[model samples]
Target chain A: MAIPFSYSLRNLWTRRLTTVLTASGMALVVFVFAATLMLAEGLRKTLVETGSYDNVVVIRKSANSEVQSGVDRAQASIIESQPEVARGTDGRLLLAKELVVLINIPKRESNKPANVVIRGISPASLLLRPQVRLSEGRMPRPGSAEVIAGKSIARRFKGGGIGETLRFGMRDWTVVGIFDAGTTGFSSEIWGDVDQLMQAFRRPAYSSVSFKLQDVTAFDQFKKRVEGDPRLTVEAKRETRYYEDQSEAMAKFLRIMGITLTVIFSLGAVIGAMITMYAAVANRVVEIGTLRALGFQKMSILAAFVMESLLLGLLGGVAGLSGASFMQLITISTMNWQTFSELAFSFTLTLDILWKSLLFSVGMGFVGGVLPAFRAARMNIVEALRSS
Target chain B: MGMGNGKPPIVEIAHLSKSYRRGSQTIPVLEDITFDIADGEFLALMGPSGSGKSTLLNLIAGIDKADEGTIRVGGVDITSLSERELAAWRAANVGFIFQFYNLMPVLTAFENVELPLLLTGLSRNERREHVELALQLVGLSDRVDHYPAQLSGGQQQRVAIARAVVSDPAILVADEPTGDLDRVSAGEILQLMDRLVREFDKTIIMVTHDPRAAEKARIIRHLEKGILTDSDGQPASPVAGS
Candidate 1:
C-alpha cells in the first residue's frame, strides 16, 4: 500500500529551510532554460508572422534573401503579367516591385550605429501587406524623398520619428509617417517610394517582385511556371515559407546555446536535490523504521521520499516559470543573421513552453530523488530502529 | 503450565536461533529458544545488556528473521513466510510500541495513530472513527491535533499505546516502552498496557530492564547470554509464571 500524500508534503514543510534552498537552485536553472526557449520562440514568431501565405516572392535563384536578389524591370513586368496575380478594386495588379537594402543608423538610446532594413516600395506595397497599418501621421507622398518608419524604428532609432530628417545615400529623406506592424519583422524597417530610393541609391534593378495570388491553391502551378521560364533566373516561394527560412539559422543558434547552458546548470541543481534528499533520509531513519514496524512496505518508504523530491521540483518549476514570464514584457533587439539587420522582438511564452518547462522540472526531481529513495527503502528495519 | 482460561497459546516458538556477523566474528544472540504465550497474556522479558532480550523481542515482532526455527502465531507458520508476506502478516497481526514512542514528529497524534490504517482498505471516515476511538481510550482525544513535540513524554507514550491498539492486532510487542520516561510516566504506561490485556484481551510481549516494569506483567522470563532463564538464573521452564 502507498503512503499518504500528506506524509511527504508535511516532511518537506518540516525541513522548509533546506527545501527552499534546493528548490531555488532548481528554479534558477529552469528560469534560464525557459527564458532561452522563449527568446527563440519570439524571434521565430516575429519573422514567421511577417509574411502572408497568399503572397509570393520572386527572387534570384541563387539568392537566400531579398537584399541579395535582383530582378530587372523586364522580369518584374513578366511576373506581374501572370494570369494568377490578383487584381485590385481599381483593376490594377496587386504587385510591388520592391528594393531592399541595409543602411547604418544610430540607435536613439545608445547612439551606436546598427544596420537597419530600408525597403523601397511601390504604391501597392502597403495594400499587399495588410498587417502594416499606418498607426500615426500620414503616408509618405509618392516620388518625394519622404519615408515611413515602423513603430519600432520610430521609437528606437535617431531621425526616425515623424517629421525628422535622415541623410542617407547622398540625399536627405523625411520621416513622414509611423506604421505599426504588430509583432512582425516589418516593425524593424523603413519604407519609401521605390523609384526615388532606387535613384538615390543608384541601384540597377529591383531586389524582388511580390504579388498576391488570384487563388491561393494555384501557388504550385505558378511556382512551376516562374521557375521554368527560360528568360528569368528566379525562384518563387510563398512569402510565409520565405520568412520562416529567415528565422531558422538564428533560432537554431539560440536553442543550442540555451540547451548547453541549461544542461550545465541543471547538473548542479540535480546534485543539490540529491544532497537535500540524502539528508532527509538520514534524518528520518527512525521514523522510517517506525513506519515499517507499523506495516508500511519498503516500496512505500521509497515512494514517500520520491514524492517529496517531486514536490520540490514542482516548486522550482513554478518559481522559474514566473521569472521567465516577465521577459515577455521587455522587448529586446538582436541581429537577424539572414539579413544582417537589427530585429526587435519580445519574448513569447506559449502553452507549449509552459508544459515543457514543468515536465523538465519534474524530471529533474525524479533523477535527483531516485537513488536516495532507494537507499531509504533498502535500509534494514532492525538496524534503522537500533540506530535511533 | 496451565493457561488461566484453558485456551491454547497464541504464539508458539521452537528451536529459534539467530546470530550476527561483524567482520568475520560470529556472535550468537539466541539459540534453541522455545516458548509459548497464552491468549490475552501479558509477558515481560528482562535481562542485562546484550542478553538477547531485545533480539528475542524483535524476532517475536517479525522485524527480524531467525537463522533457523519455526514460529507460529495465530495458527500460521510465520517463519516460513517470505519477507513480503511476513510484512503483510505483521501489519495484520502485530502492533509495536517503542521506548521513545517513535511518533513521526511531522504528524499530529491523530495522523500518527491513523498511519497503520492507511495500509488497510478502510474508508477515510472509518479510519477517522477508529483513530478517534483509540485516542479517547487513551484519554488524549483533546490532544489529537498536537504534534509529538507539543505533548509531554507521558502523553506521547499514551499516544503510542493508542496507536498500537488502534488496529486491534493479535499481538503487541513493546521494547522498553518506559525506558525513556520518568517513574510516574512509566507507571502510567505500564497501567495502560495492563488495562489493554485485562479489558481488550491483547497478547503483549515486552522487553525491559526495569524490574518494576516486569512486575506489571503476569508472566516474567529472564535471558542470559543468549539463553532463557529464570530470575534465579536457572534454565527457564517451558512456561514461566503460570
Candidate 2:
C-alpha cells in the first residue's frame, strides 16, 4: 500500500532547520547549473540569431571568421552579378560588401578601454536585415564621417550614444544614431559606410560579400557553380550555419564549465544532505521502531525518508531558479572568443532551464538520501524500541 | 492438553527457542519456551531485564524470527511466512504500542492515528471516519490537530493507543505501555487497555516489569532465564505438550 504524501511533507517540516540547510546547499548547486546553461544559451543566441537561413556569405577559401577573411572589391562585384543571386524590385542583385574589425573603445564606467567590434557596410546592408531599426536618431548618410552604434554598445562605451563624437585611428567620427537589430548578433557592433571605413583603416579589400539566395533549395547549384569556376577561389556558406559555427566553441566551453562546476558543488551538497538525513534517522530510531511495530513494512520506511529528502530538493530548486531570474536585469559584457571582441549579453532564463534545474535538484536528493534511508529501514525493531 | 475438543488455540508456539550470537558462542535469550493463547484472551508477560519478555513480544509481533520451532497465530504458521507476508499479516491482525509513546513527531494526533489505516484499501472518507472513531475512543478528539511535542506524555500515549487499534486488528501487543508515565497517566492507560479487553473483546498481550500493570490482566505468566513458570513459580506445561 502507498503511504500518503503528507507523511513525507510532515517529516520534513518537523525538522525544519535541517530541511532548510540542506535545501540551501542544493540551491547553490542548482544555481551554478542554471548559470552554465544560461551562458551557453547566450553564446548560441548571439551567433545563431545574427543571420538568415536564405542568405549566403562568400569568404576567402580556408578563412573561418569574417575578421580573418578578405576578398577584393572586384570579386565582390562578380559574386553580386551571379545569376543565382536574388534580385530586388529595382532589377539589381541584393548584395553588400562588408568589413569587420575589432577596435578598443573606452568604457563610461571604468574608463578602461575594451575591444568592441566595428562593422562597415553599404546602404544595402539595412535592406538585407530588415529587423535592424534606428531607435534614437537618423541613419548615417553614405560617404559621411558618421556612425551608428548598437543599443547595447551605446549604453556601455563613452561617446557611443547618438550625437556623441568618438575617435578611431586619427579621425573623429560622430555617433549619428542608435539602432537595434532585433536581438541579432549585430546588436553589439558599431556600423559605418564601407568605403569610408575602408579608407580610414587603410584597407583596400573587402572582408566578405553577403548576398540573399533565390531560395534555400538553390544553394547546392549555386555552390557547385561558384566552386567549379577556376577564376574564383572562395567558399560559400549559408549565413546561419556560418554564424552557428562561430559560436560552437564558446558554447561548448560554457557547457563544460557549467557541468563541471555543478557536479563539484552537488557533491558537497549531497554530502550535506546525507549528513542531515542520517541525523534525522538516528534521532527517530524509536519512531521508526514504532512504525515497524504498527505494521509499516521496511520498504515503506525507506520510501518515507527518501521522499522527505526529495521535498527538500524541490524547495531548493525553486529558490535557486527564482534567484537566477533576477540576473536578467543586469547586462554583462564579456569577450566573444571567436571574434576576440566584447559582446554584451543578459541572463536569459527560459522555462526549460528552470525545469531542468529542478530535475537536477531532485536527482541530488535521491543520491543523498538513499543510503541513510536504507539503514533506517534495516534497523532491528526490538533494539530500536529498547533505545528509549 | 489443547483447549476445547480439537480446535487449535488462536496462537500456538512449539519449542520456540531464540538465541543471540555473541561472536562464536550462542547466548540463549528464549530457550525451549512454549505457550498458547486462546482467542480473545488477555495475557500478561512479566519478567526481569534478561528474562526475554520483550523478545517474546517481538517474536509474536513478527518483528523478529525465532531460532527454532513453529508459531501459529490466527490459525496461520507465522514462523514460516516470508518477511513481506509477515508484514502484511501483522498489518491485518496485530497492533502494537510502546512505553516511549513513539508517535511520529511530524504528524498531528489525528494523522498519527490514521497511519495504520493507510495499509488498508479503505477510501479517504472511510479512512477519515475510522480515524475519527479511534481518536474519539481514546478521548483525544480535542487534541487531534496537536503535534507530539505539543501534547503531554499521557496524551501522546493515548494517541499511540488510538493508532494501535485504529485498523481494528485482532490482537494488541503493548510493550510497557505505561512504563514512562506517572501513576495517574499510567492508570489512565491501563484503564483504557482494560476497556479494550472487556468491552471491545480484543485479545491483548502486554510485556511489563510493573506487577501493578500485570495485575489487571486475566492471566499472568512469568519468565526467568528463558524459562516460563506460573505465578507461584511452578513449572507450567510446555506449549508443545499442550
Candidate 3:
C-alpha cells in the first residue's frame, strides 16, 4: 500500500514559513514567464486582427512591406476591375488604393522623436476597415488637406488632436477628427486623402491595392488571376496573412526574450526549492525513521517528498498567473519591427498560456526536488533513529 | 509463570552474529546468540551499554539482518527474505514502540494510530473503527484528536502504544519504551505493556536496563559482550525449562 497523501500535505503545512518563502521565489519566475507570453500574444492579436480573410492585397513583387511597395494608377485600376472583386452598395468594386509613409513626431511627455505612420486612404478604405470607428470629431474630407488622428496618436504625439495642425513635407495638414480602432494596429496611424497626400508628396504611384473577394473560397483563384496578369508586376496575398507575417519578427523576439529571462530566473527558484526540501529532510530524520519502522518502503518515502514539492510549485503557478492576468489593463506601444512605425497593444492572457505556465512550474519543482527526495528515501532506518 | 505454547516457538534465533565496519575496522556487535520466545510470552532483554541488546531486539523485529544463522518467527525463516519481502513481512508481523514515543508530531492521536492500518486494504470506515479500538485499549480514546505535542508524556506513550498495536501484528519490539519518561509515566507505560500481553496475548521482546521494567516480563535474559544468557546470568540455558 502507498503512503497517504495527507502525510505529505500535513508535512508541508507544518513548515509553513519555508513553504511560503520557496513558493514565492517560484512565483516570481512564473510571473516573468507569463507576462512575457501575454505581451507577445497581444502584439500578434493586434496586427492579425487588423486584416480580413476575404480581402486580397496586391503589392510590388519582392517588396518587404506595403510602405516599400508601389503600383501605378493604371495597375490599380486594372486590379480593381477584376471579376472576383466584391461590389459595394454603391455599385463600385470594394477596393482601396492606398499610400503609406513614415514621418518623425515628438512625444508630449518624453519629447523624444518617434516614427509615426501616415496612411493616405481612398474613399473606399473606411468601408473596407469596419473596425475603425470615429469616436470623436468628424472624418477627413476627400481631396483636402484635412487629416484625422487615431486615438493612440492623439493621446501620445503633439499637434495630433482635433483642430491641431502639423507641418511636414512642406505642407500644413490639419487634424479634423479623431478615430478609434479597437485593439488593432490602425490605432497608431494618421489618415488623410490619398490624392492630396500623393500630390503633396509628389508621388506618381500607390503603395498597395486591396480588394475584397466575392467569396472566401474565391481568394485563391482571384490571387492567381491577378498575379498572372502580365501588365501587373505585383503579387497578391490575403490581408490577414500579410498582417500575420508583419507581426512575426516582433512576436518571435518577445517570445525568445521571455524564455531567456524565465530560464535565468527559474534557476534561483529551483535552488530555493532544493534548500527548503533539504531542510525538511534534515529536520524530519526521526519521523522518516519512524515511518520506515512502520513498514513503509524506500519508494514511499521518496514519493511523499516529491509530492510536497509539486504542491509548492502548483501554489506558485496560481499566484504568478493571477498577478500576470492583471496586466491586461495596461496598454503599451512599441515600434513595429517590419514597418518601423508605432504599434499600440495590450498584454493578453489566453487559456493556452495559462496551462503552459503551470506545466513549466511543475517541471521546475520536479527538477528541484528529485535529489532531496532521493536522499530521504536512501536513509538508513537504524542510523536515522540514532540521530535524534 | 512457566509459559510454553506446547508447539514451535514463535521466535527462534540461533547462532546469530552481526558486525559493523568503521573506517577499515570491523566491530563485532552480536556473536553466536541463540534464544526462543514462546507464543504470548513477554520477554525483557537486559544489558549494559554496547551489550547489543537493542541490536538483538531489532533482529527479532526483522528491522536488521544477522550475519549468520537464521531467525524463524511464526514458522517463517525471516533471515532468508529479501529487503522488499522483509518489509512486507515486518508490516504484517512486528510492532515497534520507541523510547521517545515516535508518534508523528503533525498527526492527531487517531491519525497516528491509523498509520499502520493504511498499509492494509481496509476501507476508510473500517480503518477508523480499528483506530478507535486501539486508542480505547490504551485508554486514550478521549484524546483522539490531540496531537503528540499537545499530550503529556504518559498520554503520548499511550498513543504510541496504540499506534504500535493498532495493526494487530504478531509480535511487539520496544527499545527502552520508557527511557525518556518520568517515574509515574514510566510505571504507567510498563503497566500498559503488561496489559497488552496479558489481555491481547501478544508476544513482546523489550530491551531495557531498568529492573522494574524487566520485572513485568514473563521471562528476563541478559546480554554481555554480544552473548545471551539465562536468568541467573549463566550461559546457554533454555527459557521455560525447555
**If the candidates were sorted by their lDDT against the true structure, best first, what order would they fall in?**
1, 3, 2
TM-score of chain A of 3: 0.97
- List lDDT for all candidates, in order: 0.92, 0.86, 0.89
Model 2, residue pairs in steric clash: none
Residue A249 alpha-carbon offset, candidate 1, angstroms:
1.1
Cα deviation in Å at residue A108, candidate 1? 0.9
| Top candidate, metric TM-score | 1
Error of 1 at A360 (Å): 0.7
Candidate 1: tens digits of C-alpha lDDT, residues A1-388 = 8888999999899889999999999999999999999999999999999999999999999899998999999999899889999999999889999999999999999999999999999988999999999998898888888999999999999999999998798899999999999999999999999999999999989999999999999999999988999999999999999999999999899999998999899999999999999999999999998888888889999999999999999999999999999999999999999999999998999999999999989989988999999999988999999998
**TM-score ranking of the models:** 1, 3, 2
Give the better candidate number (2 or 3) by DockQ.
2
- Model 2: TM-score for chain B: 0.95
User: What would the per-residue lDDT of candidate 1 be over residues B1-242, giving only the tens digit for each residue?
Assistant: 45645567898888899999999999999989988888889989998999999999988888899999888898999888888888888888999999899999988999999988887889999999999999999999999999999999999999999899888899999999999999999999999999999999889999998889999998788888899986677897666544
| TM-scores of the candidates, chain A only | 0.99, 0.96, 0.97
What is the C-alpha RMSD, rounded to one decimal, of candidate 3?
Answer: 1.7
For candidate 2, what is the DockQ?
0.75
| Model 1 spans > 4 angstroms off | none
lDDT of 1 at B9: 89
Residue range A78-133, candidate 3, lDDT tens digits: 98788888989989878899999899989877989899988899877888889999
TM-score of each: 0.99, 0.96, 0.97
* lDDT score, candidate 2: 0.86
